[model samples]
Target: MKRRLEPGRLVIASHNKGKIPEIAALLGPYGMDIVSAGELDVPEPEETGTSFAANAELKARFSADLTGLPALADDSGLCVEALDGDPGIFSARWAGSGKDFGRAMELVERNLAAKGPEAGRDAHFVCALSLCWPDGHIVTVEGRVDGHLVWPPRGDKGFGYDPVFQPWHHDITFGEMDPDRKHAMSHRADAFRKLVAAVF
Candidate 1:
């Protein structure tokens, strides 16, 4: 049987401003006291893991061990079919040291264009969530959402590659879609649902 997350203080092991709020919002309904690793001055750990799940576990364990509390971490990325799943685990690194996603988005467009017209716009997002207790007990889950890429980008609402990626059956890009709507069907949400089912 999986260990349940008892309501109380939980550390969200991430420093990304955009990600922390999204995660906090998801955990809002649970009524747990949420704090971010950034808020606690927890240094970001090196993501040496080769896969999303491994990275998520690494971050969660790092924070949980240091803070002596339960920690949750999310490792997510965008995978382009034409790019051969490139920028997958390295999604954040694509943004460069300053974390400028606009530049990263442009790079993606440039790479895609270099492939010629026959190169498909097919793409997907992957999110892996890990929950860890201070004692090292952990639970992890992964989720994905399929979509295609677009040029010129879109709304400024979402961060990262949201502006250019439109999910299947949706006419608008994630950046253009309503936050609540995106949260309902996002790759992160999918992973959160699995996490909740397994541990909440």
Candidate 2:
């Protein structure tokens, strides 16, 4: 049986500023004191894992070992159908050294164009979350939200490829939606819901 996460201080094992806040907000209702790896000067471990679940577990284990606290980590990215998941794991690397997602999105657009319109722009966001204890116990869950790509990326409310992704049945891109709305329909939220059900 999986162990339940007790109400206490937990470390969020991530260094991304954009990701940290979203996680905090999601965990807010749990009444746990959440501190980020960035805030605690926890060094980011190399994402040597081939998949999101593997990476999430790697980070969670790393932080739990360091702080002796339960840790949560998520590894997420956009996967394109035509590109055959070209940037699946390398999504962040595609953003380049400056983490300029604008440039990253442009590259995606350019690459898509090369495939011709017939290739289609179907894509989806995937999030894998892992919760780990210092003793090596772990629970993991994954979630995905499918959508297609759009040109002239809209809105500035979100980071990464949010501006170009329009989720199924949604008229607007994730970037165009308010944070609350985005969170409700997001891959991270989907995974979070599962984690909450299992742990809390």
Candidate 3:
């Protein structure tokens, strides 16, 4: 069984500035008083989990426990098929402590090049969402968007590895798409749809 999210102040358990706004947009229609853990000065818990779901739940539960309010958290990253899903959970860590994603994208390209002509550039983005209550109840969902990797990373929009990922049918990378357009078919949006259907 799962608990419904009542319209009230809900904690968004994330310190990433990029993710907060995207999530806020998804939850906006629900009319909840959304608050971010960063805004609340809640410390980020160590992501000790090996998978996205575990990490999302960990963050959500931590915020819920601290604030005594329901919390929502998401863990997302890029997984390259050629890399055998390398940099899955460590996606952010690859950017270094300064969070320099530009260099990180370069690193990804270098790794692919090292694979020679046999490299399979197929890749996908994944997002896992978790909703947690102070009482320890939780609900979770996951989503993924498949695409192939492109060289010379295009566009200057979006964040992370968006510039290098071109979805299956789209000519432009995520970095080239408008925020609203990306939001409509993003992995985060897919997960949000599930979370909305199940919990809201």
Candidate 4:
């Protein structure tokens, strides 16, 4: 079957370096010539959505319209059950004035400090991917990984909330794990798997 996305120079509606590789890896199998919004100086739209799916669609649709090409966007964050599922949409802002995951991790630990150990500090990382075409058709997919947060952080590989997020059945954080392993269990992988299936 011919892939709906096809093979072409497409745009990723995000400026984050961390997201590009994942998106590229996911779409590469289908033979896509992926491009990033940053490469074209496309602006990132403010994510005003209350959920990951909404935000992904917002970015993807906006970029697709702006570039007149299919666009892929992802919105992902860590949700800690102990914090009332907090740091959900605010995961990026947990660090306060900047995009500092270190500060973000600190804030999470502080928030859970008073709750004490095993205070349902359980967390899961969620990723939502949106694919939009210039013709106004859009498809979205979501994926999640059950995990927990560890204090003081660990490893130095992955970014954002990676160092602190320990996946189920793993003693090390996502940052500490191999990229292949991380990608296998990652929320982005799950969503992208669904997305590729839909597109193809």
Q: Name the candidate that leads on TM-score.
A: 1
* Alpha-carbon shift of residue 64 in model 3 (angstroms): 0.7
lDDT of each: 0.95, 0.93, 0.92, 0.87
Lowest lDDT sum, 10 consecutive residues, model 4, at 1-10
Minimal lDDT window, size 10, model 3: 1-10
lDDT of 1 by residue, 1-200 (tens): 76988999999999999998899889998878999999999999999999999999999999999999999999999999999998999999999999999999999999999999999999999999999999999999999999999999998887899999999999999999999999999999999999989987
Candidate 2 global CA lDDT score: 0.93
Off by over 4 Å in 1: none
lDDT of 2 by residue, 40-144 (tens): 999999999999999999999999999999999999999999999978978988998799999999999999999997999999999999999999999999999
Per lDDT, the best of the predicted structures is 1
Global fold similarity of model 4 (TM-score): 0.95
Candidate 4, residues 69-147, lDDT tens digits: the string is 9998999999999899889977887866668889888888888997887687689999999999888799898999998
Kindly give the stretch of ten consecutive residues in candidate 1 with the minimal lDDT sum: 23-32
Ranking by TM-score: 1, 2, 3, 4
Residue clash pairs of candidate 3: none
Q: TM-score of every model? A: 0.99, 0.98, 0.97, 0.95
Considering TM-score, which of the candidate structures 1 and 3 is the better prediction for this target? 1
User: How much lDDT does candidate 3 score?
Assistant: 0.92
lDDT of 1: 0.95
